[model samples]
Target: MNSSWFRKLLLSYLPVFFVVVTILFFVFFQSLNEQNRKEAIKANEFLTQQIVLFTDNSLKTLNYQVLRDTLTADELRFFFGSDNDDVYRNIQATELMDDWKMNNPIIDSVYIIRLKDNFVLGDGSGQAADFVDQPFIQTYINQKVTAGKWTGKRSFRPYAVEKPTDVITLVQGFPHFSTDKSGYIVVNVSLSKLKKSISPMYNPKLTYVRVTDEQGATLMSDSGADGENSVLSHYISPYTGWAVDSGPTGWGLAHVALHFYNIWVIIALVAVLLGVFWVVHVTRRNYKPISQLVSLIRTSALINPYKGQSGNNEFGFIQGALEQLLEETSKSMQQNQEAIILRKKHRFQEAVEGIVSIRESEWMADLLALQVNPVGAHAFVLAIEIDRYHQFIETYHRQDQSILKFVVSSVTGEMSGLRDATTWAEWITDRRLSAIIWVPDDADGEVLSGQIGEQIVQWVQSNLSFTVTIGVHGIASNLEEIRRSHEIAGNLLQYKAVLGTGRLLRPAQLEGSEQRVHDYFGTIHGLSQSIRIADGAWQKHIEDLFSQMQDSISSRKEIESFLQFLHQQLNRVFLELSKDYRSVWKDSGAELLELGRSWETLDELKQGCLRVFEEMASKLQALKDSQRTRAVISDIRTFIEENYHNPELSLDYLSDQFMIHAKNISKLFKEAYGYNFVDFLIGLRMDKAKQQLLTTERSLQEISTEVGYFNYNSFNRAFKNVAGVSPSDYRKQQTS
Candidate 1:
């Protein structure tokens, strides 16, 4: 009777137990699936943000360059300067626009609107009137003119086209020349080309990405279906008011469903088998030893034991054990997941620092498990540094900087994933980030790496309100060489101080392909001559010297040496000058030396040097002016003594011959000799006339002619006025 009752109880409760366990398993699986979906959605959002940032940055750069080039173009300037009907000048302007359109692949059309003449020229085949008549373009022109500012990206219909399509354009007004009227340059960037540049930012298999303007009109999108049960993520661009949306592809939900189905089947099978075992054990309770053995077998599989007499039945034991087993498994899985993530981070850090001490085989295995394929790959290191790091720090708080750094790393990682390149990025320093990238062996590693580096730089600049400089090291064939590549990359970053920031530096660039040794000694000699004599062209020479230094000097050490040489030469000249001059030179020289140490680039250094030279040249010019005044007065007196007999020799003649103002000549003559220029000339003529009258048997007319007087009475009267006697009496007095 006891055995039958126990079997009935087991049959009734076993199904309930199985059903409860199945329900618990389904709930757990659903929760896990939801968590995974959230993570995927977050990743999609990050990638979309990166794509928006990259596209906006590329468009801004192209637009700015195109506008600047067109507005400042020499051909345009010449065209504006020419007569309205000048066909040759018009042709040149057309050719210039054609060349711009051809050279820049992103530029679909180029045009100019002359505000003065209302003349329009475009690269399109139709007449200029057709382009100028477009209402959208007219609005752009009016808006730009009214605002008196350059227009940002604006959507408009292309002019002079049979079928008009929406085109993104940037418009800027040309500063009116003194001779020509104002005009506007219109640059149309190919929206299709802009879309193509950023197309690689999305992976079609993983996500469907689309770019839309503020009005929700689609600008660009990948070819993919929008699947059900997918999460949507959006990134809004601050530059263009555009939004980039991304969602999982068609297979994403199906793959998730398949994964959950497998887990559910395994749980269901385990529950049924346990129910069957419990029923058999209860029916055979007469065999106490067998029951004990079965209990032991079940206990070994379970994580907890049942306690007390009432709870010591087979059903109670199974329930307790299964609950405890699942709880313990959940804890173990959570810990293992955390541990795996921690280990991967630690390994990556070690690898980036080139301090991994494990065996090569073990290291490679870890890398593969982490999805960093090092085998049959070309590897390189990219070092990224924030431009104007000091300014960046000053602008943001510490917390904000940390957040920005994380954003940059996330963008870099997502971009690398999209490119199918195995890359790991980390902040190696406060203001610098480093990435180790591996590409397939058959791929063009250099080209691919350059593209990746450019995208990262552009994206960060657009989103972060700052810029970055990237340095790429030589590609390596094996993992062992990555450390060397990293070191080289770090070394390459030092050149940013000389080459200027916000650029990419490669190993080949460091080899000085475009740089040459400048003529430092020649510059030093020219500056010396200029300072000594106060040459008027000294400023121009200084400008040219610095320009050469910027373009030709590659090595920092060499630059420093050149600067030191300049300081030394300047000091030598300073020592030879007077105290006042030395003081001025000393101050300027000190400034130049200080700038040499702190200037961020050679261009900055050159500008500082030019300023110092300008100061010194100004002081030198003052000194030269003082000496020149005295010399001018002395030369005028000498000329009077030599030409006193000439009738036309006068102050006006002297002023015209010497290019000196008559007023200035008179003032200087009085200051130097205590006599005015006219009085000095009269005194010289009278003295010469007295000598000629006394020493020669000459007539008054001849004497007057010899003394620069046109008539005898004027000479006699001038002599009497100067000497208080006639010319004859003056001669007699001199003779006595």
Candidate 2:
């Protein structure tokens, strides 16, 4: 009877025990799975940010080059001043575009259209010619000129030789200086190339990422997707009118709750099984304790084991009380577990909102020396990137790579050493570390930078055996300026000098600083030279010079005083040199005049000064160069543009007209503009062709002869090479 009861009891408890353990296991694993899901979502969000970053970077690059090309073309003296046939001017424009294309391979072609007439001028390689009458062209021109911002992804003629290629053209209208003609600058970038450029930066596992305009038309997308499946339309990017999507359904809330259903199913099964078992166990367990207390009291009353007072003995009373308390405590614990779960929900909500903050005063305890008291403090940042880290991962076993990284991390920590008041170190990122120090407020920046360098050198030598290049930035007043200083230092790092693998740099010490100083000092020299010898005004003039140099160096208008000084100095030097040799003065004067025309930048002015000084010294060294040659070359260049359309125009003709050798003329022409005479003429003719093709109803034969081409065959070949189109095909695809 005892054995049977024991077996029954064991069997009864076994189900309860198993059910309780299974419920706990389900809860634990479910919590873990939820954590994993949250991590996955966070990772997805990070990837989305990366996508935005990459797209913005690509646009910045495109905008910079596009602006440079547009401004350069707009400012060209010949591009604005030409009075030749419209066809020749158009052709010249196309040739200019080819040069831009050669420099920026990503840009397919660049063109211009007069918004008033829909006059199109471009360099494209296919039969897709510029159309002045197309609705899309008219819309693009009107919208861009009015908005004054680039209009994205408008249809355009491809080229004169090939099929029309889909392209994204940036259009903006720039008015002509003289005439009422309002022209638009159009930069056509092949959609295929844009897609190609952006696609490779994305992960292949991604469904598809795209950049679309405000109209929701796809501007660029990765391979293997139609418009509906594109990642761009899924997530909204408030910063740039772009959408970034990754993982799951490529939408917002669906991605967040994708795995919730499976989790709910498991939770339901665990809850139901545990509910039944818990009810049975509580009933049985509660009765046993009560029954034990009753039996103990009854036995004490009947048996008299404690003698005459056994019924009310301390032991009997205590036994009954302990049994009752044990049963109540277990019940209370069960209730409390449910209550604790409710409290946890509130705490979890707070964690999700991510609003934790500590008072500013409390932050000092955790702040690094580099971060604290940064006002009037010199700080620098270093960005260390591992070359082809992804490629390296593919070659090594996963376990081995992990081990290597562990070793590297361990060494980095060991070498960083202890932080102190004067110096501090931080592991800024996984691949990079930074060390910052406090120097005296007026300390020599170079010396302080050198001390930091020595510390890094010693630490690296004693720890890792691998080679590393260190990029050091000069000191700045605060941590915020550290970023820009670091950029300057990084650029210097890229330049090869005697810098060793363990090199150090203070940007203040680079040739970049020297250039800035020269600008400052040049202003002073120019100011002194501009005015006649006014007595005792040198100090006042120096102060004024410093004040003016503080303005932007690039603005040519603000630097008029500096230019005037340069002109006066050139005249004075020429006069002084004329006493020794009259021919020398004339040569110097001609070189200075030519240089003045090219001095659009301070760097250009510097180059001009250096050249003049070197030439004058050559005479002191008893070397004979040319006085008349410079003047002749400049005159010949001016003549070519004014008369390029003459069928009799030739290098030999120009050389004979100017009484100079043809070879010498060719050499001078190449030196001045970096293109051969024939090529230059072809370019001039092509620019004219583009204008006429877009502006006039002239036949191809008439346009060809008007641009100085005698034979149709020669014009066709030259036009194709320079404009990437034939004359008639270029004219047919008009878009006004």
Candidate 3:
């Protein structure tokens, strides 16, 4: 009877329990899947906004600053100011523009539109009429000068018979001469090139990002076909009036749904099987307990044993236990998924920050588990920094900045993988991203790493409209040295202060191989001596010092130390000079200090230092020139008196002795003594001859020799010329 009861109970409740559990499982899983989808969509939207912001800022910089600088450059100005018929100038202009275009790959063709001549000079082959006659070109000329305007994508031929090519141009105008009305500068950026700038924003697996003009014509898109039924987000750039649209693939949600469906099937099977087992055990166990109670009532005449009996209590316990188990299992699954995501993120952060310091064995094991095995791989670290980072932060909202960083990190990671390197990247700061790369051991690691770094820079510049500078550390032999490599890369990043932005820096560049440490103390000592003597050579000394600093000092701190030492020595010398000199020195020093702020390279700093010294030298020379002329002449007379016995004592000799020009010495002597240099020297010699004859009674020949005369006859003649008497007569008169 009990066995029959158990079978009936199992049959009644099992189907209902299975249905309830299955419904709950599907509901919970569907809710979680929807949440994940929404989160992913939000992330996509954020990334799209960042793409738009980057594109807008990049365009503005190119138009207002880069193009302006190019147009204003001396090379372009030479072409702009010259007549079109001037062949030499035209050639120079063409070459200059071509070179500019080459350096700036984003520029398709650059044109200098002369309004007065109605001519257009460009990097391409063609006459002015070929480009100047285009309808869009004329329209661009008609517009008033404002910020640069885009010409929209259009086809044009540079030569009459040449095939037309499509380009989008940025047109800007400035007066060729202040009064000239007709000159304009037109810079054409190819639509393809402009599209290329934002190409990094597109990832087929993540989001579809594209830029479009006001007319809804696509300027650039990763794929031509928009996904069907995809969720689209749009960001309109305020600077360019262009729309950036991004969306996930239409199949993304469906794929997620399919994934969840498979998971649900497994979950439902497990839940159903466990529910069946619980039902069977409860039914079988309850039969024995219930039968014992019924037998007791029948045999012992227990009056109320069955009077207040309720339905089997085990069913309620089984249902409650099943619910508890299902709840705990669902919680465990969610926790596991979250833990997995957290672990991956943590590992990536640790790797990029170079904090993963573990034993070789454990490190390899962790890397394998994390799917980033560094064993048998060549390792390198690349430190990437955004150019104009402060401006980037100021231009975007806080959230947008975060999105930009995330997008950059993602792109770097993707590019590294494409290059067959295992890459881990993270944001080390607001404007810097650091990546650790591991490639096959036998691969050309340096070249491959450099290529990857350059691609990252180009991709970011082209697609996101922002520039990044990458510093590549040297290749490491193994993962153990990766942190040290990372340190070297970080140090190399400081060279951006010297190398500027939008470049790839190599470890070899900063290793000072091309630099030679010159004699710093020797140069400084020379400079000090020159300053003290007020010699013009101080300028040269200063120049040499700065040159040595540039070549020898790779560290900013070392450079600063050298500069400080130079400044202190200068200050000491200036303090010893006159007030006017001190004031001039102070002003020059201040100017040099101001110029140092803008120095982008060691060479620039060197030039600035030279300029300061040159200015000081000029001022000192002027001060020396302003001193009393009479005092110089007086000193000359004293020098002549002491050296009267020397035959070579003439204006030339005096000039050399006093460090004064020969002509100046002669003219000053004539003015001060009322006689020429020759007459003055003769008078001094005659007077000295008379004194020698009167005092010593020496022969006339001896007296002549003593008075700087080569012969007695010349001595007598000199005496006559000065005193109107022979040397003997002068001597006799002196005796009387």
lDDT: which candidate is best? 1
- Native-referenced Cα lDDT, model 2: 0.55
Per-residue accuracy of model 3 over 242-326 as CA lDDT, tens digit each: 8877766545654456346557767766777777777777667657776666565456542322223465343344354455567
lDDT of 1 by residue, 1-736 (tens): 3888677666766665766777687768867776776677778888888887887776677666665665577878776566567778888888878777766677767777776666677744233456634564567555534422323345544443455444666666665333233666777776778777766776677677777777777777675545333437878888888877777666666345634655765776677777777667655654565567667777577344553335455545666767667777898999999988788777766766667566667777887787666534677788888877777888999999999888888887777777777777778688788888877677787888888888988888777798888888858765567777887887777777566778788877656535444466787778777876777667766776666666664556767877788788878877887887788787887788778766767777777877777777887788778678999889888988888788888678999989998899898889888989788888888878777888898988888888888888888788889889887777677778
For residues 516-622, what per-residue lDDT tens digits would candidate 2 score against the true structure? 54665565564434322323343454444534443332233434445556556546644554354546546765786677554533444555655664565456334
Q: Give the range of the ten consecutive residues with the poorest summed lDDT in model 1.
A: 144-153
Tell me the deviation in Å of residue 7 in model 3.
62
Q: Is candidate 1 or candidate 2 better by TM-score?
A: 1
The models' CA-based lDDT, in order, is 0.73, 0.55, 0.71
Per-residue error for 109 in candidate 3, Å, reads 99
Runs with alpha carbons beyond 4 Å of true place in candidate 1: 1-377, 440-444, 477-479, 494-500, 510-518, 537-553, 627-736
- TM-score of every model versus the real structure: 0.38, 0.34, 0.34
